[model samples]
Target: MSFLNTLNLTGKDKSVGLLLGLILLSHTERTGAKDKSNVVQKGKGSTAKLKEIMIGRCFNYLGTINPNAGNKDCSKLWEAFLRAFSEKDPCKITKEDYKPFLNMADHDIPIGQSIFWSQTKELILQYTDVTHKVMPLENTLIGFMLDGLNWCGKLSSPGPNYEACPEWNSCTNHSMGSFWRAASENYAMKAQGEVTVLLNGSANAFRENSIFREIELGKLDSKRVTSVHLWIMDNIDGPDKESCGVGSVAVLENILKEKKIKYTCVDNYKPVKMLQCVFKLDRPSCNTGT
Candidate 1:
């Protein structure tokens, strides 16, 4: 009190100091609110952007394949697809949850043109693109839409949780894993006539747990499909481990035989070997087609 009296503090000075303090507090609060708003906005914006890209690409591919496919409202499709996993436990999402979206995109896969691959994604894509004789899963509308994308959502969140999503092996019922399981089942069930499978000969080419072995093999209808053509492609650098009637491939043959589904295995088919040679011309294995 003595110091205030010495300085001659009056009502106007006191009021001015209080007003300045209030302004500073208000500004700080406003800035913090704006920052929080921006963070929320950015998260929402990113999720929307991903949806747009995925749905847009799907529609574009559909339109290119079937002109009437463009008439479908893909935005609605996106909404339906997101609703499958959004606001749900990432580990609890199931193949059945994706049935709605699948129904919307359902179409017949060209018989005999269906190609399945295990650890041969690159070569199969290249082979399909160059030859245009096979239709891999990635060529399908649904597969084209979600391939290589990671997404999940929470009940508390409004959109996909871009911060973190489970990996393929992290959980049995992971969102992406469920989607692929559902998609593979559809693809396999729809396949007819002769179906081609491209396998990597260098590794365990045919494993029971592989999608090709578990989903595709089980779904193929013996009444519809005449046979299965297994193309075992090895690396140009040697170390070819599996072949027809040998190793894991023989196990695969036994399964097919038991199923009464006629199958033929070709080790390093010349055309595929030629394709490999395009990438590694100097490799003796590539040159010799061994």
Candidate 2:
């Protein structure tokens, strides 16, 4: 028996089967094309997820303090948690939101003291890059700083962490780049992030000492600088040294304004024991080399 006749179907039935086969072939082709287009989109989505995973893992690893504070196992768990809850609402406030604050006036109620927002931005950037990879610098400074101080537990209480060590006055502690990066990355809502001016010794006498040093060292160029946060530290050893004085504030403000540099002075605010300040510069317009 011939293959066509073996089925014992009518001529109409044969034609119907042939038509169905053609339809199936066409459908297969269309499905394949759709899948090909989706491949590119899928790859992009996968890459974004992978980047997030890498950053979160690295950040967790660097932030680890004690032998058990954050282990590799803890990081894996944290990663899973973040992935599950990764859908952050755009309305939620983030650290970068402080960039606009430089434009706000000094007397602006809440904005006047919002030092944490910008600082957190600096911290985040330091830890994660555009690809979300954890940078080594985060490991060295923030990690070491946290680890040495025992961070959360140590800084929380008035123990050795509160002790006024000579290290606080050193370049490492006062470095703008390090401070900026750490501040930008810190995500804690409770962190003071407020700029504090420690006016010790003669407040007016050496109010501009740090600023002058920065300028002399060619770190700060008056015209190129857009704004600067002032931290006036004086007589750190004196009995009443911790008090933020009025004279320092007046002198620093007058000098900064006279230089045509938009600025804000945050005095007597101590998030931690350290006196902190922030400075903003117009990168493109800055005559000073970055």
Candidate 3:
């Protein structure tokens, strides 16, 4: 009575207030349960943003490089890419998962225009960009669109997750590595005629499990690929670790013989050396103008 007297609330008014309170409590509980069911991890970058960049690159590739790969529906291609790993365990994604996406984005490589590289990534990119006479996996649409990006999915999220992804070695079948394996295999299979392989003359050159070794080299059709031209490049300064017919390079040569793929090897192929010199003129080794 004393509490009701303060605001003069009647019995009916009290009942109405009780009902409203119950409604609010029920709404709050429902909202909480809904949020709990929608578990998600925000990736470091937006999946939408990745889609934007990828699709833009897709249109650019068709416009500039492979107009012959006609009528590509980029939206559909992106869907295929998403379907590869959506709602799947990041650690379980296999190379086979990406087959649909790869098949959608495939384009032919010109004869003698395929380039494979290991341990010489930047120089090889420079050569491809400067010369525009060859194509590497990174230059092809399947590789180009996704090269620098990292993405993964979660059981809680239907698509790419945010805030975190397992490191490359976190699992044997992590999404990115598997995708690249499929891409490398497709690239190698598409290659025809002589293929140029750029190797680091200062390192093992052919790392035992590198994509170039496991996927690209093995998938290369001996019937299609005539010879492999290995460009063993070392820094202009020093620290030459291995070169043609020596060390890891020799091991690769033996494998090539077993496969019966004719090959040639060169130390610091002049064109690449010249390209390297262009940006590193301060080095005496690059100062060849005499």
TM-score of each: 0.81, 0.25, 0.82
Give the total clashing residue pairs for model 1: 0
Per-residue CA lDDT of model 1 for 33-85, tens digit only, reads: 75443234222212346787887887788778555434566888788889988
Which regions of candidate 1 are displaced past 4 Å? 1-48, 65-71, 288-290
Clash pairs (backbone) in predicted model 1: none
User: Best by lDDT, which number?
Assistant: 3
> What lDDT tens digits, residue by residue, belong to model 2 across residues 1-290?
64346556676898876666678789999977754432222111212233344445445544552232232343443243233213322112233432222112011112123221111224333323332332222332223222222100011222121122222223332212233333333321211223322233323423334433232212323544445555333322323332222544555566656656565654322332121222223323222341
| Stretches of candidate 2 exceeding 4 Å from the true structure | 1-10, 40-56, 59-290
Using TM-score as the measure, the top candidate is: 3
Q: lDDT of all the models against the reference?
A: 0.80, 0.33, 0.83
Residue 277, candidate 3: alpha-carbon lDDT: 88
Ranking, lDDT, top scorer first? 3, 1, 2
State the lDDT of candidate 3 residue by residue for 1-290, as single tens digits: 44345556677897766666678789999877754433433334334577788889898988887777677888899899989987877778999999999988987888899999998889989999988899888888888889888887766568776656667776898888899888888888888898999998887888998889888888888998899998999977857889899899999999889999999999889999999889789987687872
Name the Cα RMSD for model 3: 8.3
Root mean square deviation (Cα) for candidate 2: 19.9
TM-score of 2: 0.25
What lDDT is reached at residue 257 by model 2? 65
